[model samples]
Every structure is written in structure tokens, then in C-alpha cells.
Target: MSNIEYQFSEDFAREMDKKDPLAGFRNEFLFPQINGNPAIYFCGNSLGLQPKNTKAYIDKELQNWSELAVDGHFEGEDAWMYIRQKSKPALAEIVGAHTHEVVAMNNLTSNLHFLLVSFFQPKGKRNKIICEAGAFPSDQYALESQVKFHGLNPDEVIVELAPRQGEHTLRTEDIINKIEEVGEELALVMMGGIQYYSGQLFDMKSITEAAHKIDAYCGFDLAHAMGNAPLSLHDWNVDFATWCSYKYLNSGPGNISGIFVHERFADNADLPRFAGWWGHDEGQRFLMEKGFIPMHGADGWQVANSNVLALAAHQASLDLFQKAGIKNLRKKSEILTGYLEFLIEQISGESGVLEIITPRSPSERGCQLSLLIHKGGKAVFDSWYGKGVVGDWRNPNVIRLAPTPMYNSFTDVYQFGRILEQSLAEFA
Candidate 1:
């Protein structure tokens, strides 16, 4: 991974693409139509392109629902009873967690709330939850509501970790320093695994170590990092984490998300969690006992029946993940994103009116680059879109372009760079 042998030339890029194991994967996705051919879609950070098989997978569930009546639960092509279980192993491989440690369940924010119920217990003088400031709005709301639900004021209970003066990204040292300096007052350390806006991949292992040192539980919002980067949640000793699959995992919009509960918590049968019938022991669930006997592991966290359509769509995308190993995807990501960084640099130099807010090092970031438009704002980005270059614009000045390895390629990067260069020229 040191100094990748990048073939920046168009011919070399095509030649490299010819040999890429994942080259054919691009065709498996349902592309957005643009003059018949697909548009240069580089917006996987916002919403992933749908897998072509997603519709077929979802249709199977619909077929069952239409034909099987109530018998679909036990007699369908794939039983609805164990629908979510189909995603566990694929998700485990993606996040480097044990299959027993993962479960496909509610959306990201909902799962965050559920995990917070069990993990974010604040007591005594240790009621503060430390997190990165300006987190994704849903995460922000979840944290605020959870803190306030404990009858604690958010202003006092939620400790925000911010970057230094005039800086856009938080450093590892700064975060660890705050955790250490906070001492025994921190009830939990919950932060984004990769900050959404800045695209910074935080030091999960070190952060967890620091939090545990002070007797605090550590958790992460892996919405932006789960499928984009390599994860070893179990080895890192992360207490709990939640993620959405629609973004980098390419599971389509509003798909059912996944959760990771450490083995320690999994084994803690005495732990407090909000339970439901779906969380009950499968063997006795049909017996409908008066008392709750929850499942042994992460399966115990589910509340209601599985979202079969969404889970099937998730399964469709995760099937691709299982084929293109996370390790392999991440390796290509570093290079693909590196190529993006390189192309963006050329654009910046040529344009002289754009700046990338993301880090220069691939190790410190993921597939995304948050580009700050200089002088020009949303209008410039709109112009780029008009030129058939599709990257997402976030509010006042930032544009987020993610060159995902699953489907994005060197040619796409080149096209985007060329569009950016021309767009800026047109503006000037």
C-alpha cells in the first residue's frame, strides 16, 4: 500500500481496468440513464447505486407474500423467520466482526437509539458522552435526545470533541487527550468511525483503549466507514456500533441497517436491553410464553419482524460484498480514492478556485473527498452537474464526491476531473 503503482494515463487506466477482478461488477448495478448510457455517478457517499439484482431479490419476497399468505413465514423460498440472519455473515465479513456479534435490523439512527439504551447509562459524576461536533444530523439528534431522556441537560451531558482553531478535521492526539483529560467523568465515548463531512477516519483502537482506561464504554457511528474502510470492531474492543448500508455498501435507499455488539456484551445475559417477541428465543417464540427469554447473542436485539424486501435488497448488495472481499474492496478503495485525490489535485491546480477539505493521506480517510468551492459555491456545483458530472453538494460550500471501488473506476475519476477543470474554466 506504499506508493501505489498508479497508471494515470488513459490507456494505462483502461489496461489496468481490463485486469481488475471487480471490473465486471460495474455492470451488475442499475445505472442512472444519461443519453442512454449511464451518467458518471460518483455519489456513493450520499446514496449508493442500486444493484441490478435488488429488484429480483425484493420480488421474491413479494411473490411469497402474494402466494404463501401467512405460510410465507415458514414455507417461502427463504423463510421470513430467518430473513435477517441471511445478512449476518456477509455483514460480519464487511465489518470484520464475528457473525454472532452482528445483526441486520432497524435503520442507523434507530439502531443507535437501541444500542444507546443498553450502553449509554450515565450515573453519578460520570454522565458525559464525548463525541465529534457537527456529526450527521440524525446522530446529533439521537445523542441529544438520549442525553436529555436521562433527565440530563444536553449542554452539560454531551461533551463535544472539536478540531483545533481554523482546522476542519480532528486529530487523533486531540481526541485521545480529551478522553484522558476528562478522567472518570466520561460515561461513554461515542463518535463517528469516519466523520461524514470531513471524511476523517478516526483512530478507533486508540480511542477505545483510552475510553476503557477511564472505565467508559466506547461506540461508533459507522455509517460512513463500515463498508468503505477495514474494521476489526471485535479486536479493537469497541463496545457497540451501528451503520447504514445504503451508502458505501450500495444496499439502496432507506435499507435496513446493521449493528455490532461486542462479545462481552453478547455474553452478558444480565445486561439491560429493550426486548420484544422477535428478540425472544426462537425455539420458544412460537410457544408465546408469558415471560421473555431472549436469544443468546445479537439476535436478541431485534424488536419486530424483519423487513424482508429491504433485507433481500441488502442481501443482494451484500452478496457482491462477499464475492468482492472487504479486504480486496478496501485495497482498491485506497488506490481508487488515491486516484481521486490525484485527479482532484490536477483539477484544483487547473481551476485555481477549488480546495479539497479531506485529508491527503488515504490511511486517514475513505473513498470520499469533500471539495470546498473557492469563490464559487453551489452554483459551480450545479454547473458541474449540468455537464453530466454528478457529485453531491452539501449546503454552503462543500461538495462530496466518493469514488467507490465497488463500481467507480479510474475512467470515472478522469472524467470527473476533466469536468471539474472545464466547469471552473467556464465559471472564470
Candidate 2:
């Protein structure tokens, strides 16, 4: 939390918004409507609201495809063949890597699978993988299947870390301790950059260091962390990582994902990978070489051609990020999330129907706060939704409210607090 004291009033929220530097960005997105009014949207952790410029970006590519036909691949300033390069500058900046270290490519899980093939080399006895216990199911499935693909038993080879009993989130000390305890048997330490359910931003830098101490490779699934949290993958000495664009990146649903490979791996063409023609060196790409001849850095991991249309939509979002600057957005994110946390605590105090499971410290969280419903569960979520508050409901009991700093205002958090208060009154 910041040094500023918080108050629970609509007037205060508006005053904060009035003074907020990023408040004008709220008009850049098209929010969902309910009863002809914009719903208070706090679901950016799941799917970000579309930027108003998205359609124009996508339509430009459609026009190129229609006019140029097959020649679109090599024609125009933004050639379809080199579409991936357009996102590299912003992606590199966002992830804290050199331009060559990052590339926009496959979807999240596919990129994970590709990265695992290169990074998760379990030799002899050093075959165990460590990850958070309740990682998103896609990750769980990917890890399980990867172990199985290697002819190893998932139970014996995959180590799932959990929070201490009765605790909502894992302590960083415990994570580092476990990495040390696992020792030489750990082949890889892969975990979410931010634990999805608890909204806990793990100490990724410390985790990476601990993993490297044991000669283990470290990677992160940044689906929930990428644009929402500040990252320094290269500086942290992280080996690899991947993230979906649809969430904080605000690209369309199921859009292209990206990867970060530390610069040390830039020219290591001998590193085993699943290669496609796109990953071949551009100089001899058209010559149809006999050998794979992988491209430099993260581009070598590509297994297919660029998805031009998707890249265009992704470019639109990345452009906004470049313009706003991630550092600026992060500054606002901490305060906005802090404001949400303060308001939730007030409501939780009065109703006692919910408990905030997200860490109270802004340093330990991003744009999201997760509320554990003690009583009404889905009904409580439904009531908030009925009143035009759009938050995300995870199974059994958690409601995730993410006040994205790019477009969400202090007033949105204030309005959500009012809706939550009313809902808790009815449900409690």
C-alpha cells in the first residue's frame, strides 16, 4: 500500500479519479453494457476489455489480405511474413529482455510445451519438476503430459508446492527453502508468475536464483502476470517464460502468445527444439534449406508461421502499452489495487461474509484481489453481477476483481465496493 490514507465514499473515488494521471485512458476501452449503462468491469484478469482501436487494426490486415492475396506475405510496410517483428520492441520492454530475447508466437500452452521440450531435460536422477499445487489446469495438464511423454510417472516426477496449512498464499521463504531442499534432483522449477487463484505475485527473482543454485532451469507461466505485474526475466536470470495476450495485454480472445528466452541462448542453434520454416534463418528461408538452421534467440522456438490477423490485434494493444509505458501503468496499478483492497476490507468488516485472500501488500499482488465467500458463494457473485458489477467467479467460492490500471478508474473500484456492500447485505 502507498502512504495515502483511504476513505470509503463515492466522492473520494471521484476526487481520486479527477487527480489520477491515467484516468483519461478509461475512455480508450469499450466496456460491456447492462441495461444501457456501462457495467463496472473488474474482470481484466480473465479477459481484458477490447480497446476501441482493435477493429481498425484487424480490418487493416483484412484489407491487405483481400487486395494483395498471396503477395501480402512480402508486400507493404507491415509485411505478413515479418509481422512477428512488429511486437518485439514492446514485448521486450514489457518483459525486460533484449529485442532478440523475446518473440510473439504460439498460444500459451503450446508455447509452454515447446519451451518444456528444450528446458525440461530430466537426466538420470535429476528428473523432478516443482510448481505450485493449484496452477491453472492447463499448466497442470501440460506438465503432467510432458512428464508422461518422457515415460516418467507424473506423481514421482512433478512436485507440487502448496501454501502452509490454513494460509491463503505461499511464503517466499518457503518457496526458496523448498527449491534448496529439492537440490540436484530438481530438473526444472516452473511456476506461475502470479498464482491465479490467490492473486499472489510470487518472488520470481528469488525463485529463479534458488533454482539456478541447484543447476536447475527456471520458467514461469505469466498468463496472470505479464502486463499486470512488473517483470525482469533477463535481469532475474530466468531461463524462459510464456504468457497469453488476451488477459492484461488486451488482445482479442485466443490471440497470439509470446515467449522470453534469456540472451545467453540467443545463438545456441544446437539447442533441441520443435522447429518450423518460420524459425529458419530469414536469409536462407526462401532457399528451402536442407538443415533446420534455427533463427537466433526466442524466434528459434517458433513452430509455425505468423498469425498475421491475430498479430495485428495484438499490435494494437502493444502500441497502447508502449505509449502509456509499463512503468507508469504499474505505478497506477499498485495504488488502484490498493484502493480496491482498502474498500474490500471495509465491506468485509461490516458484513463478515467474505475474506480477502489476496495478499494485503501491494508488492505481493498485481491488479487483482480475490475474495473468499464464506457463505453465499455463487449467489453472492450472482447478486453483484445482477447489479451490473462484472467480476470473475472461480469454482466453489472465490470472486476475482481486477481493476486494471490502464483503463479502470478509482470510481470503478468505488462503485464495485458499493455493489459488493449491497450484495453482502442481501446474502449475509
- Writing each residue's lDDT as its tens digit, candidate 1 over 113-134 gives 9999999898889998999999
Q: lDDT tens string, model 2, 1-428?
A: 44778889988899999988878788889999987899998999999989999999999999999999999999987988888999999999999898899999989999999999999988999999999999999999999999999999999999999999999999999999988988989999999999999999999999999999999999999999999999999999999999999999999899999999998988898777888888999889999868988888998888899999899999989999998999999999998888888888877786768999999888899989999989887998888888888899998799999999999999888888888777766877
Top-TM-score structure, candidate number: 2
lDDT minimum window of 10 residues, candidate 2: 343-352
Error of 1 at 118 (Å): 0.5
Whole-model lDDT per candidate: 0.86, 0.91
| Each prediction's TM-score versus the true structure | 0.96, 0.98
* Residue 13 alpha-carbon offset, candidate 2, angstroms: 1.0
Residue 319, candidate 2: Cα error in Å is 0.7
